[model samples]
Target: MDRRLPVAVSFMAATIVAVLALPLELQLAVLITTPSAILWMGRTTVQHARAKEDNLRRISEIEQTINEIAGEELLLFQSRHPNRAETVGGRTGMSAVFATTLNSLLMLLVCVALFGGKHGLTAQILYFVFITAIALDLIMGAVQLNRYVYRRPPMILLEK
Candidate 1:
């Protein structure tokens, strides 16, 4: 897991709380800023990945040179890790499912809150329901984050 993920999640939670407390115009500004920040972070991640790939390519070239000088075959990292792609697809699929479920639940909650008002729901009750939904979402997010941050690699054993 990336070290920055936790910090980003915390930042998002803070932004949501701040938005909830701010005026309507300020909340709109903050909402805009949040996506901009996310885009900047994503661009940074892409640049970092590209730089790492370039460094790996250079290392591979040097390895090829050394192999040519010594008249021996040297295996590249990719050949040694041929199974890397196989392990990632399952996790990605599961994550997609999880995200979709969470989003559906949020939509259901919003619909309930909106429709309840038509049936003479009190303002406090609507507010409570909305806040409950947000709280549930945040708690679930924190739990998922904790699982990812503390997850151990497969076959890693701890001593008692």
Candidate 2:
């Protein structure tokens, strides 16, 4: 079972509630904050996936030695390795990032449509600063995620 499914759904639900519960000004702040949070989550997922993949490669390299060891010892080694756990955790992390990105973008659009036109100078400054920051964060995250992706298959087989 994909453990991430429930978590992804719950996050979506919570984000919806948060959006609905916030006032317009705070909602705008949330919209700005969400993208950076998503980016951070994405970076974490990529790092974990890389670490897991590295551990798996190292274990595989010593598979013969591991096989010669006692069953309990091999089991302990495998348990400590992040093979399946990484895959599971990566799925959840990536899903959360994706969902968060979309949620933030949607909220951003909504905020702009609702409260964009009537802003004072301070409000306008805050709006521009937030928009720029969010955009940069999203772009940086995309680059990081793309780094992992581009390392594997260019356009053919997509593993991990």
Candidate 3:
């Protein structure tokens, strides 16, 4: 649902612009679809940003918890279970990757939609910038998740 909303809006915007940008002088279509595109892009970008922030926050809390656990407890866990790290890695990495991929694909869709189907090269630049923001947000989340999930020597370590 979250992912689909942005895609649908982008497609609709692209269709409107393509259809209206004709020499038919449909300025009304521009007035209508331009703001609609902006609104959709604005709302989707905010939603994506918030979701990315939330996921990063979770990863940070888990990392902090790991940092707090120390000494024999950490050692025992590490020794007895080698794959625990991978499980944590999968959990954090997967979430980040999922969000990133979703955002990236959406951005790509918007880009091509604008260029290939919509108002030529003019609006393409703006859409690119708009969609790029969401991509960056996704990247931010992935970086945070990686830092948390792949800390060297593990965030939680045994005190010698």
Candidate 4:
């Protein structure tokens, strides 16, 4: 409803550019960047909305009962205790950052690809590479999200 219309328009505009433009390279450039721009917009819209919702919920609940409290002194005492914060995966605030940053990079590559597509075969190959990378990044995110929700096992993060 709210999300789908913009996405559709983005792709359609890209298609129009491809058909209307006479030069193959410029057309290819439009083809490359158009959908990425559209998808980037869509993903950004949804994630930011969700993050705002979560933030609002946390703010509103901060002053509430906080799960059957006895007294103010008890609450104050418990707040000083050590709480172990375990970040299980790279799925927190970083996901959006990773997505956005990569897209920005790819968007540049997409422009580079247009020049390559027009001038040499290498550029076309590079264009595909950029698109493939974007797709793979998204797929990996889905897999990670699934693993997080299921809690299948103790997944280890191997740091280099």
TM-scores for all predictions: 0.46, 0.45, 0.36, 0.42
Error of 3 at 159 (Å): 30
- Model 2: colliding residue pairs: none
* Residues 6-32 of candidate 1: C-alpha lDDT, one tens digit per residue: 465457556655665777557546544
Q: Mark the regions of model 4 whose C-alpha exceeds 4 Å error after superposition.
A: 1-20, 49-120, 141-160
lDDT of each structure? 0.45, 0.53, 0.49, 0.47
Which scores higher on TM-score, 1 or 3? 1
Candidate 1 regions exceeding 4 Å error are 74-160
Tens-place lDDT per residue, model 4, 1-160, is 2444445555554554354454875666666666576456545543553454344334334433453364344233222323211212223434443444454445444455444545468866766677667666555553443333211235599999
> In angstroms, what RMSD does candidate 1 have relative to the true structure?
14.5
Best by lDDT: 2
Poorly placed runs, candidate 3 (over 4 Å): 1-80, 86-107, 114-117, 149-160
After TM-score superposition, what is the CA distance of residue 94 in candidate 2 from its true location, in Å?
A: 8.1
Residue 107, candidate 1: Cα error in Å is 14
TM-score quality measure for candidate 4: 0.42
